[model samples]
Every structure is written in C-alpha cells, then in structure tokens.
Target: MEKFKTLGGSEGSTFFFSVERQKKWERLDGPIGAFVRVMPWRHFGRKNLGYLFAILHGADFFFDFDDDNYIKVDESTGKPVEILPSTTVLDNVMVAMSGPTAFNHHPMMKPSIPAPSWARGFPWEYIKDEATEGEPAFSQSIPFVSKLNSIGVIHEGATNVLVPKHAYSPYNAQASIHTQPALWATLLPTTVPGRVSDIWRSYFAQCIFADSNLRLVFSPPKIEQIRNDHDILADFAAENDLYTKSGKLIDFLSSWDSEHLHFPQRVEQLWIDLYERSYIELDDVVALQKWLEALITMGYKFPELKPRFRNVALMGQFNFADFPNSMTQIMMWSQKMRERFQTTIAAAPLNKTQLAYLETHRIDAIPARDLKLRKRDHLGFYNPLSNLMRTLLRFENSSTIEAVLYAHDDALLNLTELSEGKYPFPTDKIANRIKGELSNAAFVDLRTMPDRAKARTLSHRVFPNGTISDIDKTIFVNTSSELKKQIPSLHAKYKQWGHYYCAPGQQQMAMDPEFAMYLDPDGSAWFPFHTQSDFLIVPTKYAKPFTEAATMHLKHFIWIECAFGKIVDILQQQLQAPTRLVKLCTGFGDRRGRWDVINNHDCQSESVAVFHPFKIRGRFDEFWAHADEINFPAYSSRGKN
Candidate 1:
C-alpha cells in the first residue's frame, strides 16, 4: 500500500522513537511503541573507554550478536555475550542509525479502507523496486512530512543505552528501518499488473486515512460465480499477512454476496464466507443493524424473502415479531395484561368473581334478585388465580423472560382479577380456614406474602408452629432436622395430609391451585378447655370431609438429612432395599412424600422400620450421640431440606 498521510502530522508520526548513547559505547537503534528490551549491565564497563566512546558517537541501529562479535570478558571487565552473524542481526533490526541522528525506519502497518479521507484523491504512493540492499531500495514519490522528531537515540553518558518509547527492538531496528523505501516502491504501480496492485494499494490508503470510528464496506461476489477481478490483490494481501491493521479492510469488502443466485443456501454461504474472512467480530446489536442496513441497501424484494436473509445474518437477535408470528405476539400481549392487573389490583378493592367478570367482559357485572324471585348460584370451577400468580413469581425469578410476561398481559390481567377481591371465593375461605387452624401450633408463622403489608397478618395466622409452603422452598429452613427438632416425632411421622388442601402459610399452593400445607399445633384430640381454641379449630367447610381414617400407623421413624446432590443420589441408589413404601400426605395434596419402610410386621408389636423420624438441631455433632440408638443408618432432612 501507499504511504499516505492519515492525520495532519508526520507520516506514521503517531509511531516514532529515539535512542541515547550509554557508557559502554555499545549502542543499537531501539523500537518505537510499547516494547521491552533485555540487556546486560557489565557491557558498559568504565575502563574500556567504551563508555566514553558512546558519549561522542550515536549507536549503530543494528547491534545484534551477529554483527558486533562482542564476547564476555573475564579480566574483571564484562559479562558474556551470545555470538551471532551480521545477517541474523541485520534481519531483526527494524530502524537503524549510523552516526548523528540519521535513522532508518520501516513503513507503518496500515489498515485496508475503501475510501480514506486523508489525501484528496488516490492518495497512496508505491515503490518501484522490491529489493532491500544498497542505498534505500525505494521511496514514496509523495513527500510525507517536512520534519520528524528523533528522541533518545544518543545517550548522555549513562551506564546503559536507553531507546526512546515507540522505537523498534534494539536487535531488529536496522532491518526494519530500511524497508520503508521498498514498501513505497511497491505501492507506486508501473505496469498492467501494477495497476491491479494499485487497486489494493488505493484501498488500503483510504482505510488508513479515514477517522478512527469509521470502517469501510466492500461489495460481495455473486454466489453462483466468484469474480476474478482482483487476483493480484488477493496475492498481495495473502503474502503480507502480518499487517493486522490492514486486514480489517480486506475482510469487509469480501463478505458481500451478489444477487445472481436466488437460493437461500447460496445467500447464506456467501455471507458466512465473508464473516469468516473478516477479522472483526461485531456485537449482536451492531451486527443486526448492519444486516438490516445491507438488506435495505440491496433493495430486497418479497415480504417472505427479506426476513430470511436478516435472520441468517443476525445469528442471535432475530425477534419473532420480525417474522410475523401472530400466536407468539398474542401470548406476549396477554401476559402483559396479567402483570398490569396483578400490580394495580393490590391497591384495588375487588372480589375474584367481580374481577373475573370485568376482565372477561371488559366491564364488571353484578346480578340482582327481587324478594319474589329466587335463583340458584352459578356452579363453576374456581379460577386458580393466586396459585398461578405464585407459580408466575417462581417462574419469573427462575427462567421466565420479561418479554414473555409483557406479551401475556391480557391473560395475566384476567388471572390476577380472579385472585384479588372482597367477595369470599371458595379459595379465599379455604386459605383463611387453614391459617386459623395452624395458628394453634407453637410454630412461628412464616407466610409468603405478595407484599410486606401482609407479613405480620400472615405470621399471626400460622401461629404455634410455622406454616411452610412450597413457595418457601428456597427461604424456609424446613429441612427434616428442623422438622424433627421443632415438633414431636409422632406428628412429624404422620405429616398432616390435610395441610396441603389449603395454602401453607399465606403463599398460594402450586400443586393444585386450591391446596397448601398449613401445620396445626394443637392437633391432638385432647387439649385444654376454656382456652381460645374455638378460633384455632380446623375449618373444613371449604373442602370435602375425609370419611375414611388413615390406615397406615407410625410405629418407628427415621429421618435422613443431607446435601441436595449427594444424599439424593444415595437415596436413589438404595431404592431397591426390601421395604414397603409408605404414602405420605401433606395438608396440601402435593404427594411428594413417600417413606421407605425397611421392615414392618402386619400390625405386630416387634415390627420396626430401619428408618424413622429423628430430630436434628444445634450442630451436626448432636446427631452422633443418637447414632447407636438407631437400628440402621439414618440421614436427617433437618439440614438438607
């Protein structure tokens, strides 16, 4: 490429360096830009007068072991130097200096750009000769700059020579310094072949001259037939692969695909080829914008056609809206409505039935009856609004995206309305009853409230013992150890199957929109009289009465507590042990509890299971004392849960 002026300064002025002479008189040209040099101190000994010699003359830019032949001395003088030939030394020096400040430096690494703004028109200058020996092999016909500043090339009597920042490596400066002329000669084309070379040179010239933020774009080849217009350009770029800055320009132009072949696969292939060749990896948003722009520029036809190209190019950010998916759009719209209603309904005083009516009709309706007229109530399946909301919260906190929520506004609004209201719905009454009963327990109340305003009330409801709902799976420390330690083993052994019927604590149950786990403290049939036990009594008006009593009675219990992954895996491995599985029922109907009965007799006295409920608390050490008491190994849910 030509040596073109990018900004208004010396050509490649952004990169330049200086070197200073040292006490040893062993000098070499240093590199420009950020680089480090490893040198020995003893080379600049005081008596050799080498230090004094450095004071007068500047360094020879080429100071590798190949040329100087300076070996380490033993007479209390200097350190050993590795010997190398001049050719090796010559190959490494990038910029060199003989005497004075006259230094030779290589050409700047430039980026390939389509239209550079630095020089007025075709700003690149090329060299005629390709060789590097004897005199400067080539020179840019254009004058790059009037004067360039040189720093640190000649030292002021220091023990060690110091090259200026941004100078080439000390060993390679000599060779690099002499290459600028050759690059310039190659850039200035002379023959038909040179004319083709000129095209690439011009392209690079433009790139180097453009402002920092701007990038060039090139036309892609047709999918069916690749063009042979710039074979020479490819050869030049391929040979000079080390110029990273210029590689950027070479890639942008090559990514475009021609319109000749109308196949989708063909178009994709063309785009991929360009992407692979380009050095720059664009961000998703930037890529999307670029692809969009390219489509528009190409004048894409057919509604079905444009999106296919856009999606193929975008890779990640192609939205469903771009593809005209109505169902997905509708779902998104409904979810948004659900969220809006859920948030606003907290402050609105409306019953579930009333809210449901308003959501479905776009307006609420209330029926009236006269004294003479009597009508039967509407028989219908209750809408599981609260349950759905709880699930939504869990899903939102876990994996559900905001976009999906926003889209499902309508459905969400209807569900939220069905959940929040003044009139007593079956779910609302059932939830209240469960809370009232659990309040008699000694457990602390821990409710999963939608907001902080209801926490105290919810806590008061699950009195005596805390009501831990499925929603508290993460927050509540309801492990088996805590369960056995807090309440008696008799109660823990037969976990209230009915508790799952109403929402545990105040959180909505997910198992069946209508049921949850709420623990009852004063659960025994015998308890004090004349106490405030009337309100603390179980209210089953909302659910069907269980006519049949529990047939499975607990004789002995064992509890195992462990970390999620380890203990769970061990339990699975031991599943085949000879034991009848005991079906567990929570107050709610989640049905996840099933005990492994290692041994049991048919209503016999001596029948004892290897595993049964055992309390765990304080620290893990406390459980070891009871280890001998256990018939077999036991893990506790106290810590693991």
Candidate 2:
C-alpha cells in the first residue's frame, strides 16, 4: 500500500477559508469524462486507519481517492477488474479525508497497476455512471463548515482563532450566593410588603441613594439644625476603613429628599463626588438636563421608563445616592453590562458576516411588548423599564440563545424587589432558537471535568461524555417564576463578591463586587477573543458592536479607543509600575454618571490619564486611603427610611 502525509497543516487546524469545493463541483452534469472514486477502510478490524491517494479519471480533473496499494482495472474502458468490497473501500477512503478541500482542489484521476494485499478484500467494485441531475454523493466529505462538538475540538485548517480551553490560564471563582437565587433561595424574604404610594418616586429615590429612599428628604428644620450641629463631616473624617465610612455616608446621603430642604448643589455634590467618584453634577437644573439629554442624544435611551414632563423634571434632578458605594455600585454596573452584552451577542447574526464569531449561537432580535407605545406623543408617559424588561426577557428566552456564549460581568443595577417570583418560559419567536439548541441531543457540559480522571460512567451527570455539542445542554439556570425573582436573593448574598487582584499597596484588587455567573460545577461557557484596548477587554459582544458602530460614530470610536488606552493605564496604576498594564472594560456607566472618558467629547485627550485611578498598595488599602472617613464627610441621620 502507498503511504503519504495528507496535504495540510496539523490535524484539525482550520486556516484560511475559500469556496474551493463549490468551484470544483461545477464538473457535475456538464459532460461524461473520466470518473473519480473515493473509499474508506477499517484497520485493526474496528480500529480506524487509512492512507490518502489521488488518481486521474476525467482529463485534468482528479477523482479523490487514497490507499497504499494500486488496484488494477481495464484502462481502455475504465472498468474495474478485481478489488475490495465497496463498503470497506468507502470506509477506508472516508477515514483518510482531512477536510473538504482535500478532494475538492485536487485534479481528478484514475488508479493504475496491480492491486496490493491490503487493498484485497471481499466484494465487487465498480465506479457507477455519473448522476444526470445534480452533484455526486462524494461531496459530503468536505469539512470545516459545521459547528464544533467539544472543548478541544477545532475545524481543520483554520488558524488565528483562539482556543480558550487550551490557551488561557484558569482562574475560577464560585458563583456568589449573593448574586444567584439558585444558590441563595433560602435567604430571600418570603414576601415583599405593601407598595410605596409613589413607586416611581420610590424607584427613582432608590436609584439616587441606596440605603433607603426617604432619608434624602428631611422636612423638619430642627433635623436640619441637628445635621449642622453634629460633627458629621468630622465623624466621617475620623473613620479608618473607607468602605465602612462610605457605607455610613451612603446611608446618610441616600435618606435625604432635597425637595423639602432645598440644599445647595455644593452640599449634594460633595456626597455625589465621594460615592460616584465624579464631580459632574452642578447645581443648575439646565446643566443636569443637558447631561441627561446628552446621554439620550448619544443613543443611551432611558429604555422603558419614559418620563412625563414632571417625571423628566424629577429624573433630571435625581442622583444615585450612597447606595452606589463601591460594593453596591459595581454590582449594578455589571448587571447593565450583562444585559447589553447578552443582547448584542443575541442580535449579532443580523449583520450577516461570513466569518462572524457568533455563527454557532445566532439569536433573534428583541420583541417589543408595547409595539403600540412608540415615543408617547401626549403630555403623560409611562415607565419604560417594565416594557424594556419584558423585551429583554423575551429575547433572553429565545430559542437562538446560544449556550456557548455567556456574560462574564455581574449585574450593575440589580433590583431584587423587582425580580420576585417564577418567570414562565417566554413564548416568542426568539424562544425558538434558544429552545432548539437546548433540545439538541448532542450538547455536552464541560463543567465537571475531573482532576482525578475517572471513567465517564460514574462522573457527574451534568453532561454526558462523548457528547459533541452544547445545543442540548441545561442552559437555563433561573428556575424561579420570574427573572426578577432571581435578583434580590443574588444581591443580598453576593453583593460584595468579585474577582480579586493583587497589586502595589493593595494586596488584592476587586474586579467585580457581585456573584459572577459560571457553569455550575466550574467552567466558562464563553471565550475571550480579543481586547478592546491595552486595559479594556472586549469579548465577542462588545467587540462586534464597537467595531460596527465605530465605523459610523466618532463618539463610540473615541470612547472605545480611549477605553483601550485606559486599560493599560489602570493596569499600570494597579501595579504602581510603568511596566505593568491595566485591563479596562465597560459596564455602561458609573454611579456618579461618569462614562468612559473617551466618550466625553468635552474632555481633552489628556483626561484619560486623570480619570484612570492610580494603583496604590492593595485593593483595601488603596480603597481605604482614597475613601475612608477622612475623605468622605458625613451627616447625622435622625432615622431610617
């Protein structure tokens, strides 16, 4: 039998792509010429092995075939003399195919000379007459176009694509009970109490200051007098742990309702600066209105909560009180990031690129519940959050929801109260894609890989061994009645949870302060393809959108580019070394309403250096130094909301 290495790179490397096979396939039904044959074989009886060969059939074109031995045939008439059984021969030939282009690009040919012993097998053989209507059956042998089946698997001949399972370092963190209801079901309130008279006011108030909504409004002059008398600012300065001090400030500041007292902008700005880490909120209503308008103008709509003229007036003045203290703040930020990222990933297929990263997990567009509710033309408006949430859920439950892709960031604004009860499986067109993947029998779970390798029979039943895909796997973990029901439980338990980093002065740096979603046993569902910047990381979702929008909008381009530069700055700051680089990312916005500096057209190019925080000693140490009672002035509170 003849032997030769297949013409290609290493096995299973999908490099450059082309339409080679389709081009060669133009051969069918045009004319009767020399015929080509392909075959496979079984070695070790069941053990698979084979060799690839080529022979000329029609002039110039090659019939793709391979084997060590040459089988004799009547050359003049192109008739088979003696050879192996067709099935065994076919099997052997199939085993040798490296990829689709292997035969597609080769010159069609015929075998010659005496047959070898290995080629000797039971059964008759002959090349059949060409089909008259369409392409021949051998066309299926081409590869590299279908989805991958397992973690280590790859399409043959592709390069430059990252293999996360093989390339990246592992740094797993358990999902925090504070962030996941499936883990914190026991800790949730049995039922929420009576509703506040003004849910909008309550929600708005909650957004401004975290501890409670009513604290911000003190009507009694006596209470105001006491706030001035007490050494609130001094008390704040006296505290050592900045996190605790910030919490205290948040508790006091969130309770203030300014409509009654009419406190000056300077006072409110103090609290805002300390909590949000920015000083953009000036005293003027027009200034605040301009800022809100700016965000809207930049495509950051306020989603479902359309404001009445009065509501818009209220929102313009509303501030996120101390509740956005770092721990609470970053969690909410992560949630917003999660929502946008998931939507972007799901909506990606609409672009229709040949080599998109989302080919396997294509999802449908979001469904609008209030299709009738276009921007309200009348005087009054409704809260858009509900409609937005419904739309988000509908898209989330869509059948196209690819399990292979998942969000890495935590929730930015988790309103557990809003997330109570079980949510039914969404019944919408989007649900079909997600459901289809979930029902696929070939899905496999890689979460339970054993360090102590054992037989597949007894391992955890999360995913079956030898499974080729994630299409049929258990993708949905939110078993509760409503998606919101999963919120409070997660927040209460995993509020301060995050990925820790060790840097100068800070022994550990907190990347996220909420429970991060992960595969149950411990594995990642998504893979990182590229970074948006030296410090800013962009998974497929952000990467795709940023790339698309950057071409059109200078704002997105500048912001994303600045974010990339900021990432490096952050890394260097954290390491406190010029040599170290920072990793940066966007979770929408911060508590003080600061966007990535790149997005702010008002700021000069140099501001990125200023907005980027310097790495102190360690996470807590730096937090304590920059924050603490010393920096954050305090105010005396009379009571709780």
Among the numbered candidates, top lDDT falls to 1
Q: Summarize candidate 2's per-residue lDDT along 1-641 as a digit string, tens digits.
A: 11111221224433221234322322323111001011011211110011001111111111111222233455776775322212221121111111110011011112243232111110011111111001111211212221111111111111112111101110101100010101100111101111111111122222232211111110001100112243655544532233122233323432332221221232233334433532111222232232233223323312121110110000000011122232222222222122212222221001233113122212222222232322321111111222222333333333433211111111111111111111111111110001112122111121333422211211111111111112123323222122113233221222211111101101111111111221223321211111221111122212222232222212111222212222222322333323211112122334322233212342222211112222111132222222211111121110111
Q: What's model 1's overall lDDT?
A: 0.21
Query: How much lDDT does each candidate structure score?
Result: 0.21, 0.19
lDDT of 2 at 267: 27
Query: In the order shown, what is each candidate's alpha-carbon RMSD?
Result: 29.7, 38.1
TM-score for predicted model 2 compared with the true structure = 0.15
Encode model 1's per-residue lDDT on 577-617: one tens digit a residue: 11111111112123211221211232121222112222222
TM-score, per-candidate, Cα-based:
0.15, 0.15
Off by over 4 Å in 1: 1-641
In Å, residue 567's CA in model 1 sits off its true spot by 25
